[model samples]
Target: MAHPALKNAWPIPRRIVQRTRGHGQGFITRLMSPADLGQALKPFVFLDIFDADRAMLQAVERSGGMPIHPHSGVATVTVITQGHARYDDPAIGAGEIAYGGVEWMRAGGGVWHGKEMTAGDVSRMQGFQLWLALPPELENGPAESRYIDAGDMPYAWPAHIIVGKYGDVRSPVPAPDGINYLLVTMRPGESWSYAPPAGHSVGWLALAKGMLDAGSTVSAGEMAIFENGEAPISLEATGSEDAVFVLGSAVPHPHPLHLGHYSVHTSAEALAAGERRIAELGQKLKEAGDRQTASGSVPVFR
Candidate 1:
């Protein structure tokens, strides 16, 4: 039997950044939060959903794909819902990092690495990748990376805590920028409440599957952004089946966004610096015979 749909009285309108319209090849749908929406919301940045298939994963594996990408002044959070991924970092450790896990890589100063999923296990590859802008002080620190196993994270009756502090249960993932990330799975007819920290400017909810009956019904792939006001915001499942979603809140820091070939920074100058770093790294890889054939057909952004 289908579960009852979730319902909430205060339905906030979600401003879609842009809907992605393709399959395979790193296609992503972006949703701008209050931080990226305007000056009122700063610090949160944006959320991106990247989906891959069996063919795509194989391509990434063959080409040394994603080729030691670089990032600075931001924290990239990757959570794999389906399939699996392996992260091999000389600085950290090595080996396959499976799905349902989280990788929080901070490109404070700068860093380069490649990531790909295990071949032949792409039954379903879905996940959300979030970009959280760092404050000026920490944005230029040394690069760091941490992996959190799904089983290690704390969870309660209605929600799975991924990062930051929730109620009295704090996540194992460190939040250098004072952000909160929670992945909740709600059974039909069940409800959960979350009270975010004061001064936090942004709150976002993304529906993975099933119906979230808050102010309105949200189905798969829809993201809902909320303003600061209410505490303990409630979420209830509206459909006959269980619903899975991700919710996050953070203190915002607004700055000019400059896009580069493989990174985002506060200014064109920073982007240029990042490009130089990437170019030098690429040269080193090539000299070391580390260059692998390009995988899939994802466009290389410049």
Candidate 2:
């Protein structure tokens, strides 16, 4: 049975440990960084939310979506909440990435990618790019990538399972165990509550659009981190329009974080190994010459 979304659900609703509107750069907003939130919320590291207009899209098309960049000891997950992204690639063919669609890349040992996605017909494109610190075993393993359309994603009513299980439904994003990421849309005045699974003490939500009453008002672009505990989080859509947000909860990462330009690892040795692999791949990418696809996008390079 579902937990009731009753008004004033808990006398002491899950408290908001902290809230902030993260740093912004042009069309993108940085919600959390490894140096900051990653210490508190491990496995879950960096997050960037972006809104691209026609001008922005044109600029991307000119220079390629994102400059070819290298990542090691991390997995990047891209999900769209509004509009869509177009991709013309050999692996996935041509398609539009709307809400619920995802571009998941596990930059295990090392990988360079940034042109795998392009702007679609939509005038404005909005979504998020999240980075997860990998475990020791997979952190230096093999790299992998996948593009799944919205229709193929797992859905349970108001919740779109992006990376983990929701009730009986599970996402196919190949995420690590002990983490759950969901894109939830709640109708005006609608209430919802999230009951974290066993041992999931890290919980937070970032609003993409509309307002949410999660113990306190969480406006668009704001992120609310819940106090550490097993308590459930109760929320309500306070705005007249639908409220859309991404919520995540996970077990605490057990190791210290070792960071590089675009990587996060468990130990200094792992970080060094990953950096070396990234350097090798970077050299190969340089040798691969003009690696842009006909669609003007660049594929993931390893």
Candidate 3:
């Protein structure tokens, strides 16, 4: 039997995080907040979409691109759709993240790393970067990293399971809080249904490409937050092009959040400890001659 389609009744207001208003980057990011960053995005904390033309990508590369940076108290999920990203982490493994490939890295205590596009690899380099926050229990757990090749993820139907499970397909990356991430691609006249666990909270959905029809047409770069509802959130492409987007849900862990330089925790003390740990790791890497510059030095949250 086909699972019941999940409906999104309570409308989630759209907040623009990064917009194409700037001259350089051809994409924008929307940071949904007011709800604690970790709780609201349950299992997911931050999301950024990098989409641009080859000229723009080349400009960014010339501008030094993202530098070696540090992160903690969360996991970074990088999904490449158009181009490739070369990533290196002394703590984890290093490799080239190609189109449709996913690099899942846990910055539990802390980790420093860098990512850049290789020369002559001049594709548009479009993709999404999501930050999944760790709950209080595992906020400072062991740090780790994993990569999923384009072929490894499940893309059987119109939807692709990248981080969790959909129907009979499962993701190689284990979700921490019973959460799942699915990328759905719809034909101009087609649609699909998603049956989420009852206990799970209504997750967040972002329209990456094409328009989504559910009483209203949600255009690209917009996001919808689904509250507990009956009907599955449906979509029908309005243009000749196909529609593609990402949806994620998790067992909501509504807890207070403390934002810090390189981590997110329940309290200031925990955040301090996380930073201290990361500093120590940096020192160790330096001593071992394995330290590398990160993409960006600015802390994500605070």
lDDT of 2 by residue, 1-302 (tens): 44677645754557998988899988999999999987898888998999888888788777635677899999999999888887766765777788988988999999988878878877888998999989999999999988889899989978989998888999999988989999899999999888888888899999999999997899999988999987888999997889989999999889899999999999999999999999999898888898666867777887
Summarize candidate 3's per-residue lDDT along 1-302 as a digit string, tens digits.
44445334433333223222112234545344323444555567667776877787677668876665677787878776566766544444456676556877778878775442342265566677788777776678777777667777777577667887766778888657477787777878786556665555556677767877755666777666666433355556667777777777777656666777656676677788788888887776666652333632222211
Q: What lDDT score is found at residue 41 in candidate 2?
A: 81
Candidate 2 residue runs with Cα over 4 Å from true position: 1-12
In candidate 2, how many Å is residue 18 off? 0.4
Backbone clashes under 3 angstroms, per model: 19, 1, 16
Name the 10 consecutive residues with the lowest summed lDDT in model 2: 2-11
Task: Please estimate how well model 3 matches the true structure, expressed as its whole-model Cα lDDT.
Answer: 0.64
Off by over 4 Å in 3: 1-28, 33-39, 88-96, 116-120, 229-231, 285-302
The total number of steric clashes, by the backbone 3 Å criterion, in model 1 comes to 19
RMSD per candidate (Å) reads 6.4, 2.9, 5.9
Best by TM-score: 2
Q: Provide the lDDT at 220 for model 1.
A: 76
**Per-prediction TM-score:** 0.76, 0.94, 0.79
TM-score-sorted candidate list, best first: 2, 3, 1
- Worst 10-residue lDDT window for candidate 1 reads 293-302
**Candidates ranked by lDDT:** 2, 3, 1
Alpha carbon lDDT at 197, candidate 2: 85
